[model samples]
Target: MGDNIRYKFDYLIDKGFYWSIGLRSSFSHFNKNITASLLLNDTEIDAMGLNKIGVELQDQTNQFYLQTLFRKDFALSIGAEHKRLEITSETLATNNVDEEFVFENTDYFSFYSNLKLDTYDDKYFPKNGVYFNGDLHWYLYASHFNKTFDAFSIAKADIGYAFSITDKLAVNLKSGGGFKLGDKTTQTLDFALGGYGNNLINNFVPFLGYDFISLTGNSYVKAYAGLDYNWLKKHHITLEANWANIDDDIFDTGEWFTLPDYRGYALGYAVDTFVGPIQVKYSYSPEQTKGFWYFTLGFWF
Candidate 1:
């Protein structure tokens, strides 16, 4: 985690109307470091070779919008956003000289819309109903590295359903994906999948067994199936499986199933405490030699 400052203001049009106007702004910093043995075509070394890679990103964003009430069951919002982004990286590119750090700044203006619907019976432990969320972004102007771009778009969605099989058992299913269209998209703007928590501003999704933001691509589709057994009112046991395909050209090819790249399995136990839920999960993936353990005190802050 890094520095972050965010604020929002809302004005209601009328006491009984379900509409509001809002203004929001935020400034944040994010950093990531990676070390991996990557090869191109399974033969030659990748462009950055086999070295530690570091990235530091800073962003300032402001938005003005009108929206339906932020209700538990349904909501809609349309907004215009302006963003300033700066990125600095080391060992991410090679110049064949002493210079190892690279820096760039970009600015973007876009129109976006968001829709959400949720009918889950419970927030922490849902045993019935479904939920859906979708977003669309259309960029009207972008300036990066002294170059300009217009007419870029991004679309993303997530849907989930949960139901009880027996009084003590429940099942949950979820699927989500996204696409980035237009050329010269920045690295940090790509959809990232991995880890156990979400950073919505950066489009970071959680995959059980991988490192934080480890998988990156222009397009991806992922799904999860899980079962929960309530041993008692406050105790639960869970099992889950997830599969995903992440690629730069996923929609253009017929290799979706033939190249199912990432898969994970997990088993977990949870206790509903007075303060919050405590979760302990063990997860495994084919790419790892050992299983991973995750512990969380609450859902998210």
Candidate 2:
């Protein structure tokens, strides 16, 4: 079983000033394996054996922010966010076999601001501009079984630029790297993606870019490329193909579990074109070792 809860608030202080806040929580439970026994003609015999497992997961998040538009060409903003996650799992067996339990927790804090320049409509470059965005974040994560605790922190600064290639196309580029400030061994960075759309599609927009992370300390690089397309004025589709390969001896440290080696493609689609404000979505992830599929439906304002 799984459940999630979320909340958000937005306020307009004035024509040029605004504030927003959000929160989220989640939980999950499941079972893993089981077994049974029987006897025939007074002779004991193994009737059936099964593996059953269960999982319970939970998450919570909160955010608050304020922004002010100083002029037609400039703006300023600030925000803070908080997040938490908890997970638990259990396994059952027969013949008096012992059960297993696992737990993990994570918490994070973030503060960010941006000074943006507006260049949305210029005859020479109708959809282009430059901006400077910066952020500071702290994270704390622990695993009960491993008896390990990680307190990591990082600060980042990014320079973003956008240019229009034509009335139908535009490109954006951002390149910046962050430095680890706490008990960590690697540097983190911020990247950007580019998107394109046309008036006729009104609902269909497509984008492509690389979202990547490098762990030089662990000697591994992970990256994903994908596209998001909208349809039917209320439907959305996303396709992401990811790849990751180990390059160093760090895998021997058992930390390899934190790395994403799925190395496959995933498709996700959602639509809100139903009556009574209902929404539906589906997803599939096929892997070399194991695979899974999911579906969801809901209604909201």
The alpha-carbon RMSD values of the candidates against the true structure, listed in the order shown, are: 4.2, 12.8
Which has the greatest TM-score?
1
Candidate 2 lDDT by residue in tens digits, 1-301: 2343334344445555443332323322223121111001112222323222244544555556666665655566666656555444444333445643433355555565556664544311224666554555555543343244456554544454656554434444444333345553221111111122111010111121211111123233334444435444555565555444332333455444466543545566656544422322222333333333434444331
TM-score of each: 0.81, 0.40
Q: How would you encode candidate 1's per-residue C-alpha lDDT over 1-301 as one tens digit per residue?
A: 3264443344434322366777877766767663222102212235435443566767877888777846545688899999887766665556656554544577888999999888888766778999899989887777756363547688889999999999999998999988888863344566777777534465667888876666777778899988999989889999988888886758777445464689889999999888778999899999778777878886544
Range of the 10 consecutive residues with the lowest summed lDDT in candidate 2? 197-206
Candidate 1 segments exceeding 4 Å error: 1-18, 34-45, 50-52, 69-73, 90-104, 144-150, 257-259
lDDT of each: 0.73, 0.39
Q: How many pairs of residues collide in model 2?
A: 13
How big is the positional error of residue 64 in model 2, measured in Å on the Cα after superposition? Answer: 3.2
Compared with the true structure, model 1 gives a TM-score of: 0.81
